[model samples]
Target: MLRSLSLLALIAASPVVAEGARELSAHEHGVGELNIAVAGSDLVIELHAPGADIVGFEHAAESDADKAAVEAALAVLGDLSSVIALPAAAECSVSAAEAELHIEGAHEDHDDHDEHEAHGHDDHHDDHKEHDDHKDHDDHAHEDHKDHDAHDHDEHDHAEEAGGHSEFEASYTLTCAAPDQIETLDFAYFGQFENARELHVQIASDAGAQAFDVERDAAALDVKGLF
Candidate 1:
């Protein structure tokens, strides 16, 4: 009976080892899909896992100077126990999409007062006479001022009632496949914004599970201000 129990324990342990091996292999190959975008000065990267846990990550900068900075940043990330270093030659491709910006404000029309002032000057008047004429012009200007003020107020109220606002939308797709799955999954990150200030992302499938991971990197890269 002791021998049989030992055999069962060994069988149970075999699967664990096999799973670890598979995970290691996956890590070595890295992710199947990668997407990147630039908003403002921030860089946003989204990696997808079709069925495997992301055990490692590697990034190469486009330039030598950027490479040094990227390497330094990776070093800081590697210090964390939760992260695993990826192979430099891992097979991964990144595609970036253009970012969208939207701004909204109340529109108004203003009369050309400068032109009116320029034409109203009289060459024959002395300084005192000009001052008196200006006072008289000011007195007449008040005649329709109340109606113009009310018109502006009404336009502002209409703008407020209409709830004028702007919205921006951006979409990026990543194709990643798992060893167990025969087909690749198209993971999408759709970002929406009411203004240029804040962003909301809607992820497809189980992508939300990895939101924290992406958010952490985004924050570190200062991508939050891109929206």
Candidate 2:
């Protein structure tokens, strides 16, 4: 099995399609995928997985609670140096790092509904006022009810409105002083994401391409021939 893994890794290191530029998703929930490529002194890595795998849930973030989680995830993914350790001799620095998170239904009909509802609320603002001549009572209950209904609707929309799955993909690039000397790569992604148990990695470079698996407990991989 190790022999096959090495062979596949070598094969994957060769030039393929523009796929290396695109995000490649994983096949399962707890499993994630990482793709790394070396081009001269520049190294590009991409990680893709279900949103739940990275952030613990795939539903649209409606509450204030999810922002902290999102920021923490982005912080971890944004700093490649933190998640993956590199050789000091290589003198690698993350020139560019970014993360993209997508909720399956966040911007679809749900958004349209939100827009339509926004215009609706604007035109009906006066209807919410109820006046009693004797006591001059102002009833804002209808407006309050609409606000409550919208919240409920949003929660429901995120739950069942989307098709397929929600996933996040992050890309980070590194510039190395000695790119050739950087022969190995290590990841602490497992430590960052508690639910992610396994990682599938694809590697391609000037030398060749390879494919391999990295379990959480074993979080290191070789990139000897990457460039």
lDDT of each: 0.29, 0.67
- Candidate 1: lDDT over CA atoms? 0.29
- What's the TM-score of every candidate structure? 0.19, 0.63
Model 2 residue 198 distance off true place after TM-score fit, in angstroms: 1.1
Q: Quote the lDDT for 99 in model 2.
A: 71
lDDT (tens digit, per residue) of candidate 2 on 71-141 = 56766776776567787878888877767554444333445444433333323333333321233333454
Q: Which residue pairs in model 1 clash with each other?
A: none
CA RMSD, predictions in order: 26.9, 14.2
Question: Clash number for model 2?
Answer: 10
Per-residue lDDT for 3 in model 1?
100
Range of the 10 consecutive residues with the lowest summed lDDT in candidate 1: 190-199
